[model samples]
Target chain A: MSLISQEVPAFDTRVPAYLQRLERAMDALLPPAGTDPDRLHQAMRYACDGGKHLRALMVYATGETLGVAPECLDPAACAVELIHAYSLVHDDLPGMDNDDLRRGRPTVHKAFDIATAILVGDALQTLAFEALANAGAIDAEQKVRMIRSLAHASGSLGMVGGQAVDMASENLTLNIGQLESLHARKTGALILVTCQLAGIAARAPEQVRHALDRYGRCIGLAFQIQDDVLDQIADTATLGKTAGKDQVQNKSTFPSLLGLEQAQHRANALFDEARDAARSISGDAEPLLWLADHIQQRDH
Target chain B: MSLISQEVPAFDTRVPAYLQRLERAMDALLPPAGTDPDRLHQAMRYACDGGKHLRALMVYATGETLGVAPECLDPAACAVELIHAYSLVHDDLPGMDNDDLRRGRPTVHKAFDIATAILVGDALQTLAFEALANAGAIDAEQKVRMIRSLAHASGSLGMVGGQAVDMASENLTLNIGQLESLHARKTGALILVTCQLAGIAARAPEQVRHALDRYGRCIGLAFQIQDDVLDQIADTATLGKTAGKDQVQNKSTFPSLLGLEQAQHRANALFDEARDAARSISGDAEPLLWLADHIQQRDH
Candidate 1:
């Protein structure tokens, strides 16, 4: 059940380069720290400055798999990352998860004031849609579809809705089905939309869209299960966030409902299903396959 | 300087009908109150339920002025109202304005919980964009434009930025120009976008769009100035929100900077400019003109 007991996949040589590109793009997209309302602009940049860039990677990977160029994927990539960052900023607020740290840095509310943190999150969420709308490489129709997809994924019925349920369900026992449903919205929705955005960017046919969506769903669930597992076995320094908080808060996690061994097995099965979905598309899928392995095997 | 001293424009029979239509559209667009995650959904509906709905009215009036059908304007109307609602929700939070009452009802945070209120604001903002994207009458291009406009208006450089400045400037004196700049972002941005959305919906010519933008700018500023004037003079029962909160918080306002009499004069001047801008368009501008008069004359 230990994370070290699981086999580690070899590092993909391309990930670092992709992450570097994404970081630069995001920096360019965000307002400079010196801008008027400097505190907010600074917080916005700080909240998004560092992360694993996994969501951006998913966007790029899916786009590459569908033969869409990386340049065309940058907006979707940056947009998804912004959404992820905003969620973290909100989730770490004093009224929410109340975490002091995120990605090894002081959370936005700690660094700035609570009001600034809330505004930072709000501004970042707005910037996500703005980034997509102005993604010039994508056509109007594609922009609309991407906006709809991202908004739907991030809204009440999607990521926010999931968080609501998660908050409400604290200290209450839930079956595996309920847990899966919660994670599907809380985390899976945004991840799923990253893939869906790539499909929109590529102007993929209906069949390819279906395949990509299926792949996204599987990987999304697998990723969360891995997160729950990591929270159990990983330390704060390794995870770069507060680990074991779920248990401390009496929240029912994957490891709480299913034993660590079964959760690990379930994550592995989802990873396999994700890879199969990617492979079903009749084209190069190296990036997606590597991502599947990376999600399952990453230690932190 | 008294609000009652201003001449009330002839009652526009269309205003009530438009409000009725907007209410119906918003109800249909929002998730049912009984849906799963019932509290958040219920909060979202509550946040948006009743107000003067001035922003939605602006959208309808502008669309009507441009000869766009009312049905085509419903999505834009709903979108603006949702954004307005979301801003109010966040503005009323304990860390923000700390208002306990809004539109004669307990604020979302007081009615529900702080976390739920935060999520409700976020979800409503997301729903605004989603609604615009799914607006059946508009073409994809228009939807993209509307999304971009709304996002830009609602984001840092627009409403949120305005809020940050407003918060930071507490207990500080701001000159007239600085006060205008603050209100321009905080309250003016969304109002401006309502007109722009209508322009896009009508497929208005470039000249008409420019004229509408100018008209929107004048009216947006006028509306905020009136709000400030009202806060100083109107009672809480009539305002349906806390009166004199700005003064209590030491936040700068039009009346604070310009004096009540001068602020009223400025609002009237802006109303006149707005009517002129609307009249400059080569069409019957009755609705827009009526809206301009209504904004300055409204007691609350």
Candidate 2:
């Protein structure tokens, strides 16, 4: 579930087509009289394309596991994808991570300018809600609820909060506990929202939704923990950005705070927790069980 | 109203207190533990305080004239004020407006840093939805609907689209129609959302809501037209920021396109349209009429 995991099924066959459709959807939303869409669209496409789209797959898989219709999950899946896309755009802004490259190419701001990157991020954020609001297959209240769930997950209390904490910790010392708390609000919140949204879209029972939420929380941490592990073990060829740059920034991580062996054990434990939570809920999620193993065991 | 109009009112006694409460609501929603409450609080207050607070007045006065109780309107008024505050924070970000000063103080990003400013803006945006969602005495569906309205009015098709246009229009020549289209979307959209949110809170009839929306669209343009007009007539002492920066940037503006005299006349016509729409919809709109006059005849 972290960057470019080798075992995550190769980008879905339909994903390219879906990406195409997403572009068409985005283009249609822009007014004809506005500044040329050529550049904005190009930048949006560059940033939005090439993800493994685990979020979308989770959504579609959730519906399938629950015996719900694929159509029932299409909008939910697309809405989540939009959120993921928006998060990446904002994450790569000049002020945040300041990454010049992502997924083996220039980041949006690097390829375009800072102002265009900002608009790209803003447009994507708005488009996420726009997709949910106009998702014709769902109940209006359900769509509204979906928008609320996504907003909370991506907003200050969630990912942005995490970013804030990360910013606070930079050039400072922190223990493992504090670092974990930072990641929980930042990364865990949205992953939990992901699972909860899927469950809600499937109309799963409250108990089941809670269990899936726990599962996502565990996996989110496990994913980041493994990311720390890979930051030490992996090289730039496999990991997109320069490896060990996190260390250069004096950022605290599981590996730095708790040693690599201990971080590995913690990740394994989190995977176990995810498996247990998913298994205990309704629906046999053998694929999720496989995913938990895959996450802890991935090479890159 | 333009900065040079002759009918400016002294500061309303309670508007300051209302702004304070809005500031507190925004501050309370930041990260609970990692965030420095004092810094975040100071920034929120600095970012939101000292505005004209015309949006809240519109909400409060609109509800009042419609015969709705103050209690029913407070949350809606708070919500509009929150949106205005959020927009200012984002608009002043390095990639958007790159503004370092707002309301005679350092902008949020300048007061803190760009990342905090972005997060603060994101947080405020979510809090607007949270405010509407948790607003007491409002029906659940309508609460959700009002949240959607704010998003719609501010999102891609509205404010975001306007911003994209604004950013894209740097150094480009434009006619009056194009200038109006941009401002109508950027500033006017949110103004319309403010009035609609009030109508929704008051649970006004659909016909009245629609009529108020029309009124808002008209007055929203007038609001910006006057802003453009004032940029020409007012000096820095009265206008705060560089008085004629719009012309300096070659940014398309009403006065730039229509000339100062025509821009002033267009503003009056737009205000007239707003007044007629409000009155035709209901004779009980005495407060809205007064507010409209206040908008049309303001000084500084």
Candidate 3:
């Protein structure tokens, strides 16, 4: 054998593979674009397409660390991405954030009518559970467990709860603790569940699962802080969405409360914590470690 | 036992019992009114609180015919009602039907802000799946099946699909067949799933399940026709919603497409079909039989 290394790079090399698998899985799960109720199906596909697929990456990463097969993770990765996509569609509605653009393109309600956007969001959410339940490779009991985890993470006490608080927080100031709690539920819950789902699918030991959970929690908060920092520093063109929306909406953010330098420092500290948690796991954790560093340093 | 009839009437006696069970079960499932996301939890409860409980009764009626205990059917009953409640919340949004009143109270969007209303609907839908997945009495395999069935009935090809078509159909004329197809998916899918859920819960034989499915489909269509008939003839006070809004919105309804008398005649024919299907089942099908007549003959 040659002295040169043959192994692929840790994280970047696998992202496109995971994203391609996720796209195929999600496309299969979604109703075809030209089917009856064509507009809704088309909008559902539109909303799900072209995302960064970060949450799905988390699912694949966690599953990979546990030695679970990628096909077993496909349904779950698709499910979380669908949930994320639906949330975005609803969040962009006129009564909510009223965002006209997303990912450098018109938002769902802008591309389609408001009624179709609402239905698209609703259908996408339903399709998430449907995908999980129909996952043939996963056992029935495990499927139930994943469904329960996802629904709990997405429901009133989870993501939607966070959105409610976030909407209420506009024009009102929130302290650091309150803000963390809000982010923990809003964006953090789904991110955390991405790890939990893979752990459940793999039937990982409780100790390993707990460590993975901790890594997920740390990474989730760090990801949000990075988003806040990017929202302040990045332009609309680079971000692919309107920048400085937090300040414009009067929504509190890490930089708004902690200052730019302090927010960056806090995110770095959390990244360290996430890396340490990843190290505590027993398997191939390099992907998770790289993911933490990558998420923390992403400009968008 | 005395010579005089000792048994309570079949359907009438069980109606109040089923409604009470539904109320208690739903109350247990919902977050308290003053929870962290207080507005959303409150609105979800408000949307679920005062419906006619017809859907829940269908679960009970079907389960009773299958010899499944009422408690065994509670989660499924609660789930269908939750789905129905979420549909109404979304359907009444400003961009959708825009109705201000439902069941004699202000619609969710009218009672709360539009953002909260949307989140309430989202959270409620999640809770429906959560309830099924967490149902203590249900086996995991059966839970997965129920989730699959519920999600299919609620997703793009089902209730939401119908809504999409209905939204697109505004100011457009449709044939009688087209109107039936729309209502069948819109109102009929969830109604059909209510029986399918109870059947799954009981593990009823396929032949019996098919009869129940047929009964549900017939009743579902008949129920929508009755709604259209009431929308034409009933006043706003009695109907507990805007009267004759279908004609005003220029959406084609059974009564609008066919004559009022013809629509009633179609509904009567469907009710007869439903009764026949219900009677073909071998058990205490009195409840299903009673439901068909009660739905047919009732006035708002």
Candidate 4:
């Protein structure tokens, strides 16, 4: 993450605090009881926290820039994180990516049983929509929009679609174009939805929503490419998670295709293009500008 | 079922026709296309269709009894089916019930892979909200209510929560009370939502909505009890699917907790209670009467 080198951007005053608030909001809205509440809640804490949280930050930042009251996006912010957490949980399942580690501790399936992992993932996915619908003070329609966007991003034609491609890729070699197509769904969909959800949370115009979504698509993969590059360059402690697991698995990846140097160059170029894309399409916004910078500069 | 003596009483001419329309609408609203059309669509189809039409009928009946045009409830009817379909897809996952057979055919995982089955379930869950949001020509508030009920039923406190209990019961002996709690979330949450949704579709008074929801919870458990009994009584050929697998697996179901005779008696008393529950809440309506009679006697 090129952006990881930029001193963490002086810690956005509102974002980290808002992220905490949103996390609590989400936890409160979930089932009060379940299969080993202590374990599930503990795993949820690790999975949700301890990240740079570029996605949640983007949603909050854009909503701030658009003049929407910070409180107005509580539902939206919680909804996005719920989706993000759910994706991670499912991605590590036995029949899926089958990874054993995440963040630091064992992956969800490893920490809990696979059955608990699946249900926990399912509950989180559903809790996201519940968070949207039960966001305390938001009107029902806004909650509906928030939940729908979160669902669309996490469902088919989005993150899950991308995972399907990534899973299938184990069985076939892919050209650069196919690789990008696969990443578009897996990595790009949520990132783009991040932009759209932020804009929608602000009640921004449809044009604004569409433009930020476009920005999300271009930069999301660049983020992934940088991730690929960093995996080769960075260690586990540096990245805050396991690195080079993708190569070990022989999965098609950005570094595998473009070479380390080429992938890095592509990420830098895409970041610049993303900045231009936002400016050209939706005029300009400082949050998006910083977003491009954040994606390109992160170290982890 | 102990209540199997009842018949599908002849109803007014418009009733069946109204139900047919709702079935078409519900089917049309579901199976929304994903980027990968083949796998996602087939999984969607397998997950969604061939239900008993009980949910859709409830909406139409509630509307008819309340003097609302039958079409007024179509959107809500469609939404309930979507929620039901999504739950079935998730419940059939490898980590959950692990059933390879559903509705007399191979489960979605058997037809596709486990990952596709998961995606299909996730997508259908999201599509339920999407359908509520886009249901043709419905009021904003109506849309909101439909979204609320769908989310509640699909979330942790409902179907998914019920599933956790069922899964945990594999190594434990559950008494009748525990069985009821398990089915309450697994089956009753959505059934209650179904009646609530129908009452909402008719724009019934708050009291009417409350009453029908009461009816829903009653029938929901009765339906599940009869389900457990039918697995013992109905042949695989007649059930169009595997039966008696529950006992063979040592699963703690109602019939297992109490013997077959006691379970049958309990189911019959519940059926009468459900009918009384409906009557206690509503004026004479042929459709609700027919619904109670039909559910109590169904063979499949």
Candidate 5:
């Protein structure tokens, strides 16, 4: 069965437009082809070519909820997506996951040489911070805070640290608690940062920020659990990646430990929690609420 | 003849004190060795373990010349050194330069696994910007500029981009101009940023900033030429790295394009220009002047 065939919830009418805006903003932000070091630039664009843009959506959704203008949120959207793309490129490298495919296309290291892929990932990571620093909409103080937040979430104590743990635990059996911590850092940190960045952008009040944090945490875990469920039930074509990769690599996942039915239930519970968190903020949080449902119901 | 046996310049009386301060600061700034993801953090510290710290010294010297206190400059100094260390770790990976020895010891990948080394480099790069963002001395505006400057210098258009070009140019003969451009981006960009950062910290006048820039450019080129010369003359033990790896990899160096004698003479000339640039500034530029001489005279 196709994973996309699952019953998906209706998204906000503004989502398609937001996605288009994000694509355009990202294209404009990246160095154009035929630039010097054309090969590296080309590879970077390739790595970022296609994705669901869920993270970018979160940024826009949170910003809109906090009453920030869409244009003002563009840089954060682009920056988070760039960071996501770079992480995928590195994660798919031969020395890492040794994956040959990503997003239904040959991985960067597969299309280009390993060296070019490495450089592409490194350069893309650098550009993420560059984008945030150059973001003119925010004041200098906000830019500094944004940079610090992104860096803290992306560094050894966050995504990279989680990756190190993930790599180390490839063959070892991890308990449910350990797995949660792993995915929290490996995938949740970046997602959570998207919300924090929006808060920074809108100068969100303390209560709003706290509510957004809760919403982010709930949805972040829900997103990962859904991923684990999809990996188990979906085929490679449906997932657009190497399905069952976690199982094949003997990496313990949510479904692996909790069983497929329980994992799905867990995701649904998290979605409810995420919705409640968003409700705590008395404003236009419709998009964030819609994304929580989308994350739970969407196949891939 | 051993490169270290050559007549080296006498050091400044404060050089040792500065080095000690830098070492302590870097140690404190980095995560403790016992931190989680112990292996990756260990590799990061290992890569940063020991070096001449010429880059950090440049930051301190320039800031001091511009009347910025040493304590105020510590973050920039540490940040640049971390970036330098991360670059070296990545460059020494099996897929890139394939180097096994660095700083008279096994490279990060050699001591740890390839995967761990890659994570170490990625995490360390992230931490560099984090350090700059969290730097307490500078105001938010200065911090943003510093982050942007460092990111621009370290990105594809700068260090990473130059590395990509260098890898592509391997086994292909490059003229002196090509080599200069390559080294300017690869090695010189970070060095130049050290001085630029000092200017940013001090909020130096336009003229002082321009002179410091010229000084940085001259010293950057001179430093690379001296590296090329030392690579040709020094053995593995004296150079503290695989001295002839460039030749073995069929890579071109300054002495390869220009004759050894011409390379040495060119370095001396650049050193003179750098000294003059420092003298143009209206302050006690003694440290900058001494560094110029040191670049020309030092073997490694």
Candidate 6:
């Protein structure tokens, strides 16, 4: 399943450009870090600042491959990133994972008081919806659809539900199917919606949208498996988070169920499927292809 | 400012009907209590139940007055109530107010674990936007506008901002203006947006919408002042929550700064203004007038 034998393209030259654009858009959407309620606002900006911007890159890459303009995708990009950031902020609270670091910095509750951390998460979630609601260049119907998809993906049956199940599953054994379902909701739902947002923004036909969704599904699971693998092999310094904590927490991970080697093989299989789905779509999918490869090969 | 001189109409017969409709609509929107992730879903329902339904009632009353169908207003009503419920859940967290009782029942964090409470709040907040986004009978444009208003009112610059300020202001002296500003955001923003949702649903003219906004603003402040006044005068049994906690927590209140009598007078003044605004709107105005009177006269 290795892609090294095939002719590979250079890294997407557009990645840095997309990252810059997303940052600018996010800054515009966020409240000024200096304003009153200064502490909460500053924390909000801080939580958002350092990240891989992976979800946002999905939005931009998917939309651009479908020939949608980059500017039109900014709000959707910001929405997913904000949702991701807020989830981390809440997850790292004392009642949850109680992690001290994220993105190589102190967690929100560690840097600020717990109350401010809760508010920051709450406010960031609100801002995600606001960004989509106010996003220009898209029609009202599409915006509504995007908002609906994003909300559903983030709600109890999706990301939050997954988190709840994950929490409840701690110290309990889960079969492979159950673990996949949980990860599908906890991380995969948001990842899947990133592509959905882009498809909605592009006004893509049903078939193209389905293809993009398939692509998203594959990469989403692949990315998560890779994460689990990294937790086993990567150091805390490289991961920018406490590594191997999953084993310590006794949580069921892909590697735990399938063994590390089988787990990585599974991720490779998903990445290959993702590449095929990307190729099935009309227009340039080189970026999607590049993203799939990058996700599979990333060490941290 | 007293309205004792005017002859009052009987209580609005539609109030109970609106409440019934809102409850049914909310039930339909929420996941079944017995579903998987049972604990989180159950806690969400638990937090939502037993509220006074004042915000949803505001939506129903105002929309009905402006001639929007009750069915059209149901989603908006559910949305505001969801937002209010989520706020209460998070506000009761140990890191925040650490309240043990709400509406005479154990707080979500007390009945459920803090992790469940946090997820419940997060899920409910997502559900609020989902309700608005999926609202039937409204055109795409109006739905977008409602979503925008709700998100803005809920985000950093609105309810969350007010909460941050309130938390920071504990044990510190705040001037009358500062206290009012804080309460306006903490409580008033959501209340004001309730009427705005109704107006948007009704597609009311700008003039009438403006009048409803005036009525909402007046009643919102009046409502908060009455709450402060009740905290000073009422006991825990009557308030269904911990009374006198504000003073105990060293939080400033209207009666604390203005003295009890003056604070009550100020609430009455706001009530009178709300009545005038309600009268100006071209509609039955009876429901709104009744709501204003009800809010002003409620003991809890």
iRMS per model, in Å, is 0.6, 2.9, 0.4, 2.5, 0.6, 0.5
Clashing residue pairs for model 4: A1-A298, A1-A299, A2-A297, A2-A298, A3-A297, A3-A298, A4-A297, A4-A298, A4-A299
On TM-score, the stronger of 1 and 2 is 1
> How well is each residue in A1-300 modelled by candidate 1, as lDDT tens digits?
567556543337767777887888888889899987888998899899778889999998888788788888999999999999999999999888999989988899999989999999999999999998898788889888899999999999999999999999999999999999999999999999999999998889999889988999999999999999999999999999999999999999898999999999999999999999989975458789989988887988
Query: In order, what fnat does every candidate score?
Result: 0.82, 0.32, 0.97, 0.41, 0.83, 0.85
Q: What is the per-residue lDDT of model 3 for residues B114-182, given as tens digits with 9 covering 90 to 100?
A: 999999999999999999999988799999999999999999999999999999998999998899899
Task: Summing lDDT over every window of 10 consecutive residues in candidate 2 chain B, give the lowest-scoring window.
Answer: B29-38
Global fold similarity of model 4 (TM-score) = 0.89
- lDDT digits (tens) for residues A1-300 of candidate 3: 595566757777888888888888887888789999898999998998786888999999889888899999999999999999999999999999999889889999999889999999999999999999999899999999999999999999999999999999999999999999999999999999999999999999999989988998999899999999999999999998999999999989999999999999999999999999998995458888878877877888
Residue B105's lDDT within candidate 4 is 80
Rank list by TM-score: 3, 6, 5, 1, 4, 2
Task: Please write out the lDDT profile of model 6 over residues A154-211, one tens digit for every residue.
Answer: 9999999999999999999999999999999999999999999999998999999899
lDDT of 2 by residue, B66-149 (tens): 766656666666667766787788787877777766776778898798877776766666656656655666666667667668
Worst 10 residues of 4 chain B by lDDT: B29-38
Docking class of 3: high
Which pairs, if any, clash in model 3?
none
The per-residue C-alpha lDDT of model 6 at residue A146 equals 98
lDDT, candidates in the order shown: 0.90, 0.72, 0.92, 0.73, 0.89, 0.92
**What would the per-residue lDDT of candidate 4 be over residues A168-193, giving only the tens digit for each residue?**
67847789998888888787888877
Candidate number with the higher DockQ (1 or 6): 6
For lDDT, candidate 1 versus 5, the one ahead is 1
Off by over 4 Å in 2: A1-42, A297-300, B1-42, B67-75, B202-207
Q: Summarize candidate 6's per-residue lDDT along B161-246 as a digit string, tens digits.
A: 99999999999989999999998899999999999999998888899889988999999899999999999899998999999999
Chain B TM-score of predicted candidate 6 relative to the true chain B:
0.96
